[model samples]
Target: MSQLSETTDGHLLKAITDACDGRIIQMPGPMAVTGVYPERSPPFKTIKLKGIEEFLLASARIGNRQPIILKLTPMDAVDYEAIEIESNKITQFEALEKHLVDHLGGYFNLLLGEAGADGLDAPYIASGHSLNAAITIFRREVEPLLARIKATRLAKAEQAAALAYADNDDWGTW
Candidate 1:
């Protein structure tokens, strides 16, 4: 445990180092959208997602380790909602992508296109705040394993090709 390490934060540091084996990465999440969306200019949209405490402490070798990523969203309310849908709609992590293509896709379409044009007709969600959790997954440890697999496969193929060439040369005269 190195003191004054940049990666070392309070609880997150102890959580990562005090354990018996493996590596850990921990960071805070941005939980609020503080910017304003002006009308008649850029498309008006903002988002607030939750944070997750991830662990990659699998004791297996680099070839067998499985990285773990997890998050815990707070149970809080929101400041605004669509005029048509309920005001208190809470969002969740339905997909494991880099963006919110699943959670806010439909609402965004309505807000920027038809809903605004049709004179504010809300559907599933109307004007209310909601809490949501966000998560992104990665496997830096397993990547080496994958590379080893590919290398093994390629070597086998090359060996077979060499054997075939040798057999042809030896049998050509017979």
Candidate 2:
């Protein structure tokens, strides 16, 4: 398994916000991944986490999904820079981190009836229109897990808690 890092960065926040935005865009069942993506598309370009422009800040539909998948590159290297077109020229930006998070969970509680007291009964995606708003909402949903980590101060505790609460969803086509 890859080593885990305690530091969170803008790129990860961006990815989460993108996934949250997907919650709003595709409302039929599964949520669509959306966020500040490439302002312009280049032919034969590989869609990775790096080489992106943050200035344009456009809502891009990177890929389709049966279930939402949040893929964060890898913040350890601290690489992955985005590019932008400035004054009819190509310029690179280095504001966002390489990787923020890579979480693959269900976001289907939105179409459900009500939420359980555990908070997992509801949808995990945050409702927001802006990037900062998405971040705030995402943080709120994840605060509980963060608090658990801080309180335990042990990887084993955090792992057990996560595993215990792993299956929060109660939906599946039968």
Candidate 3:
């Protein structure tokens, strides 16, 4: 059981900063921000969170022009536990944490023209391409991954319930 720290937001900030080799920018209130240079150059990437929102907002400029942004939501603790268990079952538990770390790295790559952002709906903030691109990537990539993790979590819960029922000596003693 890892202990949560006040500044790290339950280790989420640490996970992100460590993954990106970025440093946290101190700010007042509940907002947390991390700045990283994927290419170790100008127009770096910034990942921001306001309070304990469900998602983190990330943005960067490609060629120091045209800001690209995306949203990423961390897998819940239960999902992590499920993934850990599944990985252990497959004898790959040792690398499970690394995969989680790689997710941040992958997000950094996405901002560098590694993926396309088009036909993205703009429901908020009519101007500035940030929101649209962010929502697009979130829907196209992040959402499905979240769904898969959720499925794994649900399956784990179901399996545990089934096992408990099986072990109950009076299960059918109605």
- Best model number under TM-score: 3
Better of 2 and 3 by lDDT: 3
lDDT of 3 by residue, 97-132 (tens): 343335533443343222223325322212222332
- Candidate 3, poorest ten consecutive residues by summed lDDT: 81-90
Candidate 1: residue 49 lDDT (0-100): 40
lDDT: which candidate is best? 3
Local accuracy of candidate 2 as per-residue lDDT tens digits, 1-174: 122223223223334345433221111222222222343343223333333322223222222321112333222333332221211111111122111112212221321212222455643543312333333444455434444444545666779877776665654233
Shift in Å, residue 44, candidate 1: 10
Q: Candidate 2 at 13: error in angstroms? A: 4.5
- Runs of candidate 2 with Cα error greater than 4 angstroms are 1-4, 7-117, 120-123, 126-128, 150-174
Ranking by lDDT: 3, 2, 1
Expressed as tens digits, the lDDT of each residue in 1-174 for candidate 1 is 354221212212232223314333222454433222334254334555444433333221111122111221212333322111111121332222212223333333333342133335422322222212211111122222334444666788999987777768665534
Off by over 4 Å in 1: 1-138, 169-174
User: Where does candidate 1 clash, by residue pair?
Assistant: 52-71, 78-129, 84-122, 85-125, 85-126, 86-125, 86-126, 87-127, 87-128
What are the per-model numbers of colliding residue pairs? 9, 3, 0
Off by over 4 Å in 3: 1-15, 18-140, 172-174
